[model samples]
Target chain A: MDDVTETDLQAYVDGQLPEARRADVEAYLAARPEETSRLAAYRTQRDALRELHADVLAEPPPARLVHAAEGIRGAMRARLARWGLAAGWIVLGLAVGATAGWQLHAWNSPVARAAPGIARQAAVAHATYTPEVRHPVEVGADQEAHLVAWLSKRLGGSVRAPRLAGFPLVGGRLLPGESGPVAQFMYQNESGRRLTLYVRNEPGSGAETAFRYAREGKIGVFYWIDRSFGYALSGELEREELYAVASQVYRQLNP
Target chain B: MHAAEFVALIPRLRRYARALVGDRASADDLVQDTLERAWARFHLWQRGTDLRAWLFTVMHNVNANRARALRVHSEFDEDAPEAQFRPAENGLLELRDLERALADLPVEQREVLLLVALEDMSYTEAAATLGIPIGTVMSRLSRGRERLRVLMHGPQAAVRLKRVK
Candidate 1:
């Protein structure tokens, strides 16, 4: 047909033309051998390009990409969990209000408020230092004895770097915290994933609590206060892995 | 939409990026940037819409911005398409030639071609992803395919003779 346009022919090659017009383009190409060959060439080029990069699809995606994807899932879950916590607090507050209105203030205790701060600080610290290639830590693991001693002195409390099974201590650093100096011990696994232990001297922070999780972007923090010192273990590792590492840190520190 | 759905598109994204960038590491970096931005702006994306197209749109913007920034610092002339796609010295392989030809295309043309040819995107989807009109997409596709053909196989004078009729 005289109406068969170049776009239609191109669409034909791409299989993008609507089914109703396909036969028309085929008939148009039947008379024009050159157009047929050109379309054929275009098809071949498409196939060659696909074939060339086909291996990329087969190759497993890099870990960082997966982590980034998982980060979105984690971030969303964290947001939902945060909303759930707030909803839970509201429900508890309402029940408490019905029983004794004056007790509502207790729910907003200083310790509950302080936990998030520690997790946020730890997450910020982890995000800041984990990406360093040449200098991930201030005091290298070789000087673990001095590193711990220096951190313990600056933090105004005795602190020991936890020996994680897969993650060897890369070193430790002292950072400015809301209350005072905070000690951050860095650890790196065989695959170059880094985790940090953030310890702050928070006296009168109340009784020890199990690991509480907080996520900031890609970084996840599992933090708690034990014996008046706030401890937050931060990493990009999954919750279970970080939890297991935090449990190890707790055992080693208390032992 | 769920992040799992986004994650599932990674393989296709990687394939498209690898073809688009012509280098594995840079391609992965592009995908990474794309995913990060998409994740950050996930709220803006409407549910039940084509997530793949939306992700590609994010990638297209990211890539265009990067390319613009790079052009400012680049020493070579981007318009010198002929100089860029010169055949390799050793004449190694046909696939390499195709790669070079694809790379040498103007970024706009290359994008349309890859979206249509490699990614199997419809003209409308490619247009939407690149934020161009569908007519522009078709024109770019036509020009890109012709240029690619010329680059891959020297000027087709014989084919042109039939067109003169």
Candidate 2:
């Protein structure tokens, strides 16, 4: 009652003061008419300002803002579509021997996109494999050392074949990549479930990062960059199993 | 957020915009620029974060840049004869008293007051939007209100007693 402050009154108006303190302010104001008049004027000012601007909240949002956002999103979609079409043509040109060298360079081109590009590479790899029984791999798991050495030379970085003890190694090989040479190590579990480990160098800067996972079609890719080599383990394996492979790959390459 | 989701938040953005820029037209333009930038950088957004805050941050930065350009333009035009105003036929306020009172406030004080009182931002939100701390927001809001009250009523208090007698 003897020591009320302006801050306390302002906090009361702002509904920030605790209930007990607010009650004290209210009691003090009731006994002091001059203080109450001042408080009333403050409240009147607040109300008038609110009245002046509150209606704006209910008004329609300006069309220009909406159009501006739509325009940007539309442009992004268009740009992505154009890139997708060019990629499809190049990837198609690769399957035919006439444009193999040029198409191989296109495949090895370093362009980062959301999901579709990784999915396309994975689909192409899957189609090339799964059918080959005799020559699915150039260097099989029996020669793990030679396979790793050959891929390490082609990829221009140390390469290790991640051991999937639970899943038997079917075979492995090197392929022409979008950015450079690529490696695919195929594994199959007792249930006839097959998984592919895809490796390529990220085009350009070679900034290696951690494993990234994306599921495209029946295949799940756990991709990561370690020492400038990018690896993607693609399969229909469960998320836990995929992480298990990625963890082993991360450990061996990193260690 | 999608374009539709972002579009829905534009009214609140406009309120903040209008509070930032005194003129409605300029505020709308600032908001438009903010929305465009937000959409372009939408892919860069990490999932499950406060989109409203992100939008406000963009709007605040864009407004600051626009304000800088405006300040430069105003500086060069300061001595130009056309820079002086004759009252237009269609100013929204009838009583030039409140308008004069608002103009009398320093720009910083005026900005803090409009952001809090008109835009209804909590001190934390206002601080974040203004790129200041919550304590500063409270101090600015309180000081701005105190100044506005003095400007609006100090002369009137003296005049009122003289007329009553």
DockQ of all candidates, in order?
0.21, 0.20
lDDT of 2 by residue, B70-158 (tens): 78322322112221223324423333444455555555556666666665666667677678876666665655565556555663321
The iRMS of the candidates, in order, is: 9.7, 10.6
Q: What is the lDDT of residue B91 in candidate 2?
A: 24
Give the per-residue lDDT digits (tens) of candidate 2, residues A112-215: 45335544686579667856777777888888888889888888876677777677777678888666778888887888777777777766634443234567
The list of candidate 2 runs beyond 4 A from truth reads A70-255, B37-49, B72-104, B154-165
**Which 10-residue span in candidate 1 chain A carries the lowest summed lDDT?**
A99-108
Global lDDT of each candidate: 0.78, 0.64
State in Å the error of residue A169, model 2.
30
Tell me the docking grade of candidate 2. incorrect
State the local distance difference test value for candidate 2.
0.64
Return the top candidate by DockQ: 1
Worst 10 residues of 2 chain A by lDDT: A204-213
Question: Model 1 RMSD to the real structure?
Answer: 17.2
